[model samples]
Target: MPEPYEERTGRRQTGPFAGQTKSPTDRDGRAVTFEAGAKQPGYVPPLSDHLSPNQAHLGSTSAASQPSAEDYLQMGIDKHEKSQGDEELSESAHYFRKAAEGGSAAGCVFYGLALRHGWGVQRDEKQAFGWLEMGCATVMQKPSTDIVDLDRRQSLMPMGTQNKLSAEVIMAIYEVGNCFEHAWGVPGTKRNQPNHQMAAMYYRLGAEQGDRDNQEHLANLLSQGKYGLKKDMWEAAFWYRAAIDNGLSPIGLSWVYKVRLLANQIRAGWP
Candidate 1:
């Protein structure tokens, strides 16, 4: 239960409406009283027998057929917060499925998690894998650089297929990778492989497409030979140099260059 506003604030809300009555109290530990049956505007409409058409329009799905992704996510969060019983958990799964079908990437991810854990859904690794795959692929198909301009000096991306990708989308790709690797909601499986390999792949794709963070991560991978990847000294040097030239980090690249030189010297002497 939340603390009543009156209890928290030293001042208390006195009466009902405008010009009806108003007063401020300095009193401590007094329960603030309100006029009985005072009505206010901005009522939160009940979850209608179904969602409104507007919500469906935003989601590209029929409101009657499914709750929007936002609503379902809220429902899941609410239930989780309340530590609800099994019944609520089941309801959460149902809503998550509806939202996922409506193309909510978040919904797909959560539903996949539920399927993996048998929480509010039957434990089904195959289904979970499919949902996880979809979520990852959705972002991969459209890199964030295609959506938004992160540099504040630059203008926003045009509102069409050519639009730049938003930072949100890039972050989502990273999160999806975390999900696959960490088994957050879904179980760790081949679909959700571990250790940054999948992350590296996605980051490389994003970097190649001009996402700054992806570019940086890809550079580090090349420079350090991450994930047991074969270290190509020249290729590594090239990427590090490219990143530095792109205004990423000159110092980091310099360090990598030094290491590359040392590695070459060792190789030349080995014969």
Candidate 2:
């Protein structure tokens, strides 16, 4: 005689898949056979008994039902800001990855941030640098149109679109400079740290493009003579003035005032 279900299967025969048997000759391979009147595991009760009409749409994957890239990005931001656990942070990172893959530079930067800090993903300096670089490259990769062609295209585009594009480009440039300045996602030891010369170069690039933050950063570096740059108070003052003109607030006010005072003294031959 066959053993009882508990003895043979090592489990109580009580659920939907219970009261089933396998062919003795091929017991290991054959599918289970349910006894007559036994409820199959795959059976589901009528939806009318459990789900309301409004809840019927709970599970869907329609094209129109999918979230847009911007929507994903906003969701990521919301989750990241309110995240109190690793799982929530990871979900935020997932949304950021989706947005980045959808070609959003801001998304790329945030994803890089997540990687760098290990907020929602593993800490990977190389990968973070790569994403940040890609974000900057995306902004700089405009079509090779001449100034006239560029102006013509810009004039044809809506004002909001043009402004949005410009903002993306500027933010990308500034962030790239920040990465270089702070050695973010770069590997180095105390004896051979991040190259300040490269940092200054990037800052100069952004500053020339009218980014006030980069202008202020470049001024700070020049004034300090750090990063292999020569000490040139005049040049530093020039950048400080440029930054001020571009709406960089009072951070450099003291430096500007002192530089102007020394300049006045030299001009009046007062040593």
Best by lDDT: 2
Model 2 agreement with the true structure over 50-124: per-residue lDDT tens digits: 112222332222244678666676777777656656677789889878877877666676677667556557766
- Supply candidate 2's per-residue lDDT for 233: 72
Candidate 2: which stretches are off by over 4 Å?
Answer: 1-65, 139-165, 187-192, 245-252, 257-271
lDDT of 1 by residue, 92-134 (tens): 6787787677666656665665665455566666677567556
TM values, all candidates: 0.42, 0.57
Q: What is the lDDT of candidate 2?
A: 0.55
The candidate maximizing TM-score is 2
Each model's C-alpha lDDT?
0.47, 0.55
Model 1 Cα shift for residue 162 (angstroms): 5.4
